[model samples]
Target: MYCEITYQTTGERWGIFPRDIGEFQARMSIPDSINSGDSHDTIVKKSVKIEIMSCSFTPDEKNKRHREALEGLVDRLVKAGWEQMTERGAEWYNIKFHKEMQK
Candidate 1:
């Protein structure tokens, strides 16, 4: 099975393997830093889409079950204000405001 996880922040894209979902979440956990405390940051919003390809699984499973799970995870992140970047064909979001805490 192959999966392309697209993030739409800074237009950067990342390729994700089915088994590497943990790694993907970890990578996204990194916080972004900005200089100038006087500067007020503007929020960026983006739409998300998860594209998947599985040889063994039926399309219904991929689109319904697996995709739902993936979107659910993403929804949790997005609610925290993660926006996607468009880079290459993949999508990525820039999330760097929250201080590092235990997830």
Candidate 2:
């Protein structure tokens, strides 16, 4: 198992967080890694490609900022233990990341 973002904020906690602003999300803290028997951080995050939950992309500054912020947030999440996952080698690319799959 990889590191889990057990670290939380004051208002509320979730397995997920709001992906609106990068700085806002940055204010939050992730759980500190635990030491393994070897006296080192025992956990790591999986390398997965995750994208924002937006329905569409706009060619504007705000959209650009949001996208960049989201990317940064993903990196932070990975570092903090919110590891990424893939089934058919597809990257996670939406807010409803865990939706019903087609049979």
Q: 1-103 in candidate 1: lDDT tens per residue?
A: 1112333222223456332111113132222346434333332322333333323221233345445644564576557654433432312222232323445
TM-score of each: 0.31, 0.27
Per-residue accuracy of model 2 over 1-103 as CA lDDT, tens digit each: 3222211122322235432211212222233447333332332222222233322221122546445644665576555545354431221222111212235
Who wins the TM-score comparison?
Answer: 1
**Least accurate 10 contiguous residues by lDDT in model 2:** 88-97
Model 1: ten consecutive residues of lowest lDDT: 19-28
Judging by lDDT against the true structure, name the best candidate. 1
lDDT on C-alpha atoms for all candidate structures: 0.34, 0.32
What clash pairs does model 2 have?
A: 7-31, 53-95
